[model samples]
Target chain A: MEFGFSEDQTLLQQTVRDFLEKECTPDAVRSLWERETGRSPELWGKLSEIGLPALMVPEVYGGLGLDERDMVLVLEETGRFALAEPIVTTAVVAAPLLGRLIDTEHSAFAASWLERIASGDALVAVAPEGQPLIADAHVAYLLLLSHGDRLYAAEPDHVQLTAQPANDQSQRLFTVNWDSQKALCLASGNEGRSLQAELLDRGAFGCAAQLLGVTDRLIEMGALYASQRKQFGVAVGSFQAVKHRLANAKVDLEYGRSIIHRSAHSVSTNSPSRSVDVSMAKSFIGEAARFAAGESLQVHGAIGYTYEQDLHIWMKRAWSLDLAFGSGAWHRARIGDALTEGGLSAPHFGFEPRGL
Target chain B: MDLTYTAEQQAFRAEARSWLEASVPKQPLASFDTPEGFEAHREWEKKLHAGGFAMVPWPTEYGGRGADLLEWLIFEEEYYRAGAPGRVNQNGIFLLGPTIMEYGTPEQKARFLPKMASSEEVWAQGWSEPNAGSDMAAIQTTAIRDGDDYVINGQKTWASRGAYAHWLFGLFRTDPESSRHKGLTFVLVPMNTPGITVRPIEKINGKKAFAEVFFDDARVPVANRLGDEGAGWSVAMATAGFERGLMLRSPARFQSTARRLVELYRATLAQGGFVDAGLRNRVTQCWIRAEAYALNTYQTVSRLLAGGKIGAEASLNKIFWSELDIEMHTVALALLESRGELLPSAPAAGDVGDWLEGYIFALAGPIYAGTNEIQRNIIAERILGLPRK
Candidate 1:
């Protein structure tokens, strides 16, 4: 029983990394960050041209029809490059969410949306009920919103977006107010609830992978800077204090890698331990990202704090990702609940301001 | 990646579990440090060997079933799940046996391995000395050659199972002019050899689980050596790799401990109703770390089966597991709060706490098998490509 990715998966990872290295540099991210919408037409077109937006859509519906395992690697590359586009919101999250709605009332609409998404004609965002922070709501052509047991596939015109002051300018968040009845129905009752639950798992699991990438990049940035930064007429990395701190960060990064990979495997395969692993990845890697970002900043001395350094780009990105999909404590509490309660049944994450 | 066992592996697991379920002693065996308990442990090892279960990963001719590494992992998981007693012959079967299979001559294998598998000659490690714990190259133990025999001298400290082991394996200074890792010899010497002495050193737990072995002109044939005299350093490093990587502490051991820890946490919750979220989070954290390590080992074993060799990065694994063990037990103690101090025989004991004894034993984990500090240095220099200090 192997616990690592396959040869094909490794190849996919390398290809995505290569593509991002060419298309989505720090300059690209900085350019997008300065935009009103944080949307890059050229880069977004490149993502769709490569069939990434179709990775989860069904092949019968004119899409790549790949699994969550494939998405995991792509998401990591996105994190590594600090890609500022709505790929996670559209391709990774929405494409799959609609794929699972084939048996629901919006079967025809979901299929059409999947095709549109595959061709880069549509951008999708999610405003999942109880999870108030909606990603890319302004740019999304369709928003997947859940109300009670009903899943609605809505257009932005039917849903009002109130932009928030975002932690990571590369990716913006909005509080969405929607007319549920005006939207096309996707699913309702048990099917809808199950769909939303699975979406939450997938989203959290995807965030874990991205956090791993963020942390890995943070550590690399830290180690490289420490090696060059001089202290006492020698490299800072030569000192035990600097070495040990980076080593501890390395330890966290490595340990978090195994958990993140396991999360991807289990969630993709629908293993019995999927929820368990997702919680582990969310909680473990969330903390790892913070630690890596904090320590890397400490290692860089001062310039790391500035926007000009490019390091803060990833630092802000890691924080934004970690703060989303549940705080570490929030996921840890679910883990604690699984440890003591009904064993991870209906595991939930994030804020709910309701009935106001 | 697939994480399920094959049908054959499942069958093998069933076979091992059924045998263990029936054969494992209902009552625990005595501690190996005591004389009677030592004999009992030896007998237990003999029974395991007779069942072809002593060393599942060893080749068939060497008294194992010729099981692959994954099967060996499954065997260990089941072994611990069945509440099997600790391996009294671990030093021989896990550490030195694999080292021998790799480096021993046919004669050395024929003479030493079978007896080792059968527990007729339990072994102790002679790697550490008073002058050398983390800096193993500082060993001053000398074994000068005289005709066909080597006159052994100097002292070895912290030889686990030395007090009751029938044989001990270690490195010695074979060349007088040489220093550090040079001129050292790795040899297996019988504990019954004249001029050899074993003195059990009381540990913090008041148990003498290991001892100090002094060689005062002890004489042994040169044939006892595993490899060439000065080449011992390289062979010793391979053995250390095995110790820190796979053999000495399999992931199953920690997984089992984690399972028991969950049971403890559950029982604690049942009786008391609640633990703070911090402590509960810690319990989950420990469980996650154990599972992560187990999966990591699976990946490593898969790599090995596919022709990958373990390297100094195993120092990272050592640091990870050792620290996880300490954290798991420490949190358990905190969960116990007051009963944390209760001994195993205490009236309130319910198989839920380390009772400070196991915690005490775990304290030596990072110290032995190379201190965590040394492991970090290895990671920094070898794995991370940092400058050596």
Candidate 2:
């Protein structure tokens, strides 16, 4: 197996890293946090125009159709800047969900919608929370997974919304009421379940990759702050306690990144054992991000606690997504379950997410 | 880009696993923590050697299977899966064998390698001194020039199996006037040589895994010198590379241990209900970390199969896996609660208290080979290209 990144993926990562660093800074993150909408529509359009959402879409559908590592690079860069965008939610998650839909009975509708989403022509926000038909926020589409069949997608307008205060000021959560009339059934029966599971696995990979970025950036920021900020006439970083903490954080970051790379490879190849891997990645990286972010805040002391500083942006970003899909604890249980089951089920490729 | 094994590799794995399943000893060793344990395990090694499962990468003349690395990795994974005993002569076969293959005189290979593969002699490492753990370059174990031989008069600590080793191979200073590295020479000395003394160190676990050796004019023939007289530094480094990097403890060993830990955890949980949240959390963490290391090792092997060099980053794998072993055993102990404090002789014993015993053995992990702190420094300065401290 080739562990090295493909030349194209390497170039793509470099390009996206440059784009995010140039276009979005901590100030940009702050501006987005202050806004009620939390995301930048104008910047979203630019990313869409540049085919940011289409990297994983097949070339036949007028998209780049790159692999999971490419998306990992994009999400990683997006996370580095703490970009307040749902490229992860829209491009990596919803768009791919729609891509799966196109291969099923809903091809006609999914095809047009996917093409529009791939280009900058259309927009789709993830279902805020609650259920598919119960979103509290307005969006072009609501993504939901049902137990028996495919994901039932409903328009936000058709669902009754209930608002809840989110942990991060930049992001809000919503609960929705189900309305089959307004929903488009993406995948059903075995296909639907299979599609949703695969998508979640992929999304878990994306989340882990994003967390690696978050942890790496926070570690760098914390180390720099410790070295530059002096306490008692010496650099705080010089203290053994601080150094050990940073060292531990660095170890956590490396371990987290290693799992992400492995999980990405597993998903890309349709390895049947991807669940155990994804669970391991999500659980390990989830804690690593939490630890790194918490230690960063501690190292920075009082200023880091204040909303004015940029560290909380990353802290909130990690916390929000970490709890959204599943917390570290949840993944840990999954790992335990997999281990107790003797081993994980081997991953099967080419089979639709539905059915065995 | 495919990480999956080929059909041939898969078949080879099945074959190895089946053979090991039939051949591996059913009874666990009397002790995995002593020199006697090493000797006891040596019989198992001999059985494997006779079965053609030993030294898979070496040539047929050397009593090897003449297989490639993928086959070797498959064999290793399956060996662990089958719960085979640890290779008692690992130092001789893993490190010295490869070094001799590359840099030894033909006579040296003929004399040493076959005996090593066949377990006729067990080898011990004599590199670290009391003053030189992380700073191995500062070794003060001197080997003064003598007529037709080198008279060594220094001490080495933390020598694995040295107390019962048949022979020892490592660096000794031959030119005190030269730089620390330049004055050194790698030599093989029979443990039975005159003026040699070995004192086994009873560790916190009460097992003697290491020893301290004293040489009061211990003479090793000039013919036993490896490579050149003054080129010992590089030769020792090659052996250390194998010891610390490739197939040292074998990935399969850790994989099997991890698998067993998971099984043991589940069984304990079944026999008893949830003892505490903290212990459960730790158990889960250990299992996952171990699995991650297994994957990391596979990636390392795959890289080698694809003709890539294993860089210093490989140190991270050892650091990760060893620490995980410690953590897993720690969790296992806390789960046992008061029962964990009991001796092996106590009634209502659990799993021979191997986990508890292993927990104690694992305490030396960061202190041996190289400290975890030193490993991090290597990663930071060498792999990450950070500036030196």
Candidate 3:
């Protein structure tokens, strides 16, 4: 019962992280934040050149044919750098959703988009579940929209987007104004509803993975700053008060990380508990990331509160992602509902398989 | 990464479950803090030893099944699921047993481990003293050498199970001139030695779960020393790692508690009681934390199997599980409301479950096994490389 990443997976994640270290530096993130569109085609191209967008696309569609487990770490690298492009929304979430459409009548449409996504020629923005805003909608060539039991695929000309600036300006969120009749229906009824559920789980899983990375960065920054920024005749890190704050945050990050990895496995295997598992991951990691951001800022004193500090990039991303896909409270409530319905058993806790 | 148990592991689990199902006491045993309860638990341990399930990961020569960490975890899950009694020799099997395997001489292993596995000699930890609680290195207990024996003097407080334990293991300053951690020695002492006294300390729950041990020129053989005289600090740290890490507090224990808490929540709802959204959320959050703890332990075990050592990062596991234990109990008590205060002996207390007793015991989780505060300091300093100053 090995519960660890494979050497190949670790190497793949490291390769992405090394690339981001050079290409998606804090300066690059800040530069994108200042842009009118808050988007960087060059950075996206470089990410695609490394096969980031094709990680989850099936090999039959000129992609890598990997799953969520393979993409979780790469998504985390995107979050560690606070990459301006919607890599998670497009590559991790939308690409896989489009790939799943191969079995439906919309196979041709999905294949064309998948091929474009694999080739780095197209960007797809998936609307956050139950949220009116869609990130990177303006930059995306295609938009995957869900309405009740119907899922639609819309091109740029079929939908209108009004830019809605977020606290994390690097994320180009927009309120999409689109008509379902103008878009092509990908799936409907039971299939559409199931796909929608899968989309939410995948999105939440991706966000949880990213939050793990963001929390790790925040703690590292806090520790580094506390060590270098001295007060009271010594490094503030020498004080138990400051040290313990970051220490507690690190504890939260460690546990939340395991939950995210477990959720990745659940999503990859299409486990029956995938929805609840994703909720658990999102809720726990979301709270952990938020705590890390706050504590890191506290440790940095007034400097962290300033706009010039790079810590804000991760802090703002934490805030944005915490509320994206599904808020912690929303996911907690979903878990509460499941617990009440299922009456709390071994299966719920992943001890024994349930309907597998 | 694969998370499924192997066919052999599954078979092991099935065997353990069946054995525990048939062998576990139909009714809960009395608290091991008392004499009769201690004897009962000792008997239970013998039964477990006879079944070769006493220490799943220990070698066959030491009364174990020679299983891996994963099977041990599976055995723990079955043990808890079957409502088995708590281990009366945890201080021996979990902490010192592993330390012995790591540092003990061949003769020491032959003399100590088999008995420890069978609870023939229940062990109590003698780490903390009145003046050296969190600062354990401040231990003043001296074991001055004379001929072939060491005369032990000074006191050790908060020694878990000391009241009825057959033996006690602790660190003592071997060099009279040495201070703090230097020149210390890890020693095992028989409780029946002359000039030794054990005065039981009552816990907040009014049970003698621990004791203060005093020694005045009590002589112990040099053979009882677990490691080199000046290297006791490192040896003790290894034991602390095991205590704070995976062995002492397995996730299945809390997972079982979480399952019970969920049952309580369900029962509360079925009683037409007022259950608020916040309380429901807390219940679900507790379950999630338990699951997360289990997953984290699996990750750690996986790393260990792949030849990684558990270091200061064990501080992370200590803080997480200790707090999680308290949180689960707190939420369960909130669900019980006033009923939570009922003692097990109280009339109409059957539905109250073990929340009150469990809660009182759990409060000590963060206190013993290195206080959570101490764990945080370790994480910050050793792990994060924060300056100690």
Candidate 4:
């Protein structure tokens, strides 16, 4: 049996890689990062032209109907560039979650939002981690917000223009305000928290996958820098210290990949470990990004820390994403609390499937 | 992408389940935690071979079903599900069999495969030496060419299953002057050869499950050689790959065990004292990890079915479940609390001590079969394109 991606999948990946290399290059990303726009609207249309925005949407709804794996591949490539795209929020998160929430035969609100999302006209913005969120933003057709017992999405009346400078600073963040009439209840009470938790878990898993891709690129950047940037009459990469750090980075990448694999597999199977896998992966990879990025910067020496260098872009994203959902320490604490309360099953080989 | 088994596979699984249900012994089989216990387990293995349920991975020519990896996985799942005895001839059938299939002379296959399948000749691996655990290239086991035979001399440590194993398949420095990895040759030597000696090492659990074997002029026929000289490393890798990949443990077995763990948890919780909120949270977490492990196995199986080679990423699966094994046992002990101190044979303790025993056994999960540290090294160097340290 083959575990490699299918020929079609390969082509899809290659196409996206090529597109990002040619159209959404590092320079393009830097340009947007400088502008402080969360997305490239023109590029957004171009992505729609290439049909990425519709990959998860059903053909009947003017979309690609691609599977979750395919969507993940796209997101991963997007992350490699650290692209200023809301695909994760709009396509993967809001669309799918909204798809599930829609009471098909009769819900006008759901149908209208689905049509807008499918047509690639509407964009969704998720709340920054640890923020008190208002479910109404001017441009967003639907804003997902959760409180103790409720999840709401509605129209905004007098949205605030206050700047909420996010860690990624590149992605635009705004503090929003809205009245009760604009808040359409997605779910009443604690069910909303469960829904939000599930969505957050998916988001965490996706972010981990993206971070893994970024880590791979960071390692490559370090390798290239080490090869070219000479010191002591030889390429810096020739040093054992540099080599070992890169090697450890490689180990982190592999570990992160395995964790992501476990998380993805759990999500696909609706396994009980879905949350745990997601938590472990988010925790592990968050730390991995920090290490890999720092090592990569060190490998590149002084140039890496400069704003002019593309390396800082990755470092910024890495730091930003590390703290995005929950930091590594946060997830670690969750796991630690669980282990202290209940004995860990398969603690060392947590996800290895053997004869149980 | 489909993880579901075929109709033929389903039928095979059904037949296997029924056979196991009808034939499984009432009492627990001898454990592999000790060398003596392993020998006791071998007798149970003979019963398996007599019934033709052992060695399903071997081809039909050797009296097996000529099954593929999928069937082998299924067979292993059923073996563990039935609470079957530990594989006494695992080294012979799992490691050596596959290596022989790829590189053995026809005469060698014909001579050894059937006997190996039937448990007539159990085997142990002789790869790691005291100085060459991770760096197998540094092996010092010498096999000097002699008239019609090889005179072998050196020591092999941590040769798993060696205490009662009948034979050994290993690499030797056939050309000492040659470069480290270039001088090796794979060979099979009888465990009880005149010049051979074995001493079992007791583990923390007071069980002797692995041994250190020494050889002094252990004359073995050239016919026992596997593949050509200088090609021992590749052959050994192929053997180790199978051991680590599919044979050491199958996903189905783990899936069943996970289910059983849940059952055990439910039973333990039924006692009420253990049902605190913290315990409940942990139980849920363990349930999640177990489920994730099972799904990952399914994904691996699906990949295999889709015609992919299980490569370095197979180590990913290995790392995942090995950690899980430790976690599972640790959880079991926490469930037992103070009773976790009991020895397996203690009169006051029943199976409660098995959890503590398993907890100790779990410590080795990441150590042997290539330490998780080494696995991470491989992942970085090979899988992740990281620089070699």
- Candidate 4, residues B82-119: lDDT per residue as tens digits? 77766777788877887898899999999888888877
Candidate 1 regions with alpha-carbon error over 4 angstroms = A344-356, B347-354
Per-residue lDDT tens digits for candidate 1, residues A140-252, read 88888889997888887898889987878877889988787798877789988877776777778878888878888998888788777787888777777777777777777
lDDT scores of the candidates, listed in order: 0.82, 0.73, 0.90, 0.71
For candidate 1, lDDT tens digit of each residue in B1-389?
76666778888888998999989999888778888899998988889999999988878887888998888888888788788988998888888998898899999998888888889899999999889988899989889999999999989999999888999999998997899989998989999999998999878767778999999999999999998888999889888888888878888788777766777778778888457767777887887788778777887888888888878878878888899989988987887877788888888976644437668877888889898888777766666666553
Across B1-389, the per-residue lDDT of candidate 3 in tens digits comes to 88677778887888898999899999899999999999999999999999899999999998888988888888898899899999999999999999999999999999999999999999999999889999998989899999999999999999999999999999999998998889899999999999899999999878999999999999999999999978999999999999888899999998999889888888899998768888898898899999999999999999989998879999999999999999999998988888888887898787787898899899999999999999999999998889999
Give TM-scores for every candidate, taking all chains together and pairing residue i with residue i.
0.94, 0.87, 0.98, 0.82
Ranking by DockQ: 3, 1, 2, 4
Give candidate 3 regions above 4 Å deviation: A343-347, A353-356
Q: After superposition, how far is residue B313 of candidate 3 from its true place, in Å?
A: 1.1
Candidate with top TM-score is: 3
Against the true structure, candidate 3 has what lDDT? 0.90
DockQ of 3: 0.71
Please say which candidate is ahead in DockQ: 1 or 4.
1
Model 4 TM-score on chain A = 0.89
Worst 10 residues of 2 chain B by lDDT: B380-389
Winner of 2 and 4 under lDDT: 2
Please give the ranking of all candidate structures by TM-score, highest first, separated by commas.
Answer: 3, 1, 2, 4
